[model samples]
Target: MSLDVVVEHSVSLGRLWSEDGLDIMIAPTSVVVADALITWNVNLQWVCDLDYVPDQERPLDLVAFAAPCLWRRRMIAALVAAGREHRVALSSHSVTALQAAIENGLGIGLLPPESVRTGSMRVLKTSAGVPEPLTVQYGLYAHDRRTPVVDAAIDVLLKDIPATPGP
Candidate 1:
């Protein structure tokens, strides 16, 4: 029996193929309910620091993870699609670091709504336009030479993971 774990920005089961092996792949979806554009807080002082008036278009300094991360890629694509101009003020690999930057009032960043700590941050809906929400899908791959043990494990995993919602 062989087991392999892969962590990647994209899911590509075809690349994991091996000769004389059948691969069973499972991809779960909608792990994130919503992807929100967030800031430290929405208040008079914070608004004044931004030097912007309400209901107006303005370029914003943005915080994002380093390139090659899917979240960053999606955020950039959303910004371009919305026709909103932005500059990256900070970039880090750590989500905790990114959140700290946002808390320091560095710039706005994208995060799953559930990940946000209540009272420390606020969700912002752009008047210009909002980005499409993000969702996560997990993929599991296994070889076809199924031992009884492997089959049982696979069954448990399939039963444990939540099913994706249908359209």
Candidate 2:
């Protein structure tokens, strides 16, 4: 038996899991389906680069994840609430690509702080005219079609993956 891991849009992951194309999926709670057995995970608070100050006078250039990624909606909604006009300067499915774009000063992105690699990247605070992003609930999902190997894999993952962040 072999194991494969894929990272993509949550909805695609959920669809694959429902079809048995994937044995397990770790995705946002919004994608959870009726057939899936879900274990509640952590809430991911998204932040942007510290230098990302929303300019109300101009259209905000955005670095974002491509479509089917539900998290992108949260970013857009937050921008709307802040009354900032926005345009997507760059979009990618890979977090790495998005991070690179942000680092290069292409545009502002609502990113997971954990994904920030460069020292130049700092957390943009709401005080800095940046909108406060919504916290997304993420979880591990599996279905009844699991094999013994799949079950064992799930056990190992649940045991290793922390349900909450460390202090």
- lDDT by residue (1-167, candidate 2, tens digit) is 78778977888887786677777778876776553344444433433455655565778788889986787788888878887688989999988898888877777787765677547676666665667756776777677667899898887877866565311
Where does candidate 1 stray beyond 4 Å?
A: 1-58, 136-138, 143-160, 165-167
Q: Pick the candidate with the highest lDDT.
A: 2
Candidate lDDT scores, in order, read 0.53, 0.71
Candidate 1: residue 167 Cα off by (Å): 14
Worst 10-residue stretch by lDDT in candidate 1? 39-48
**TM-score of every candidate relative to the true structure:** 0.58, 0.83
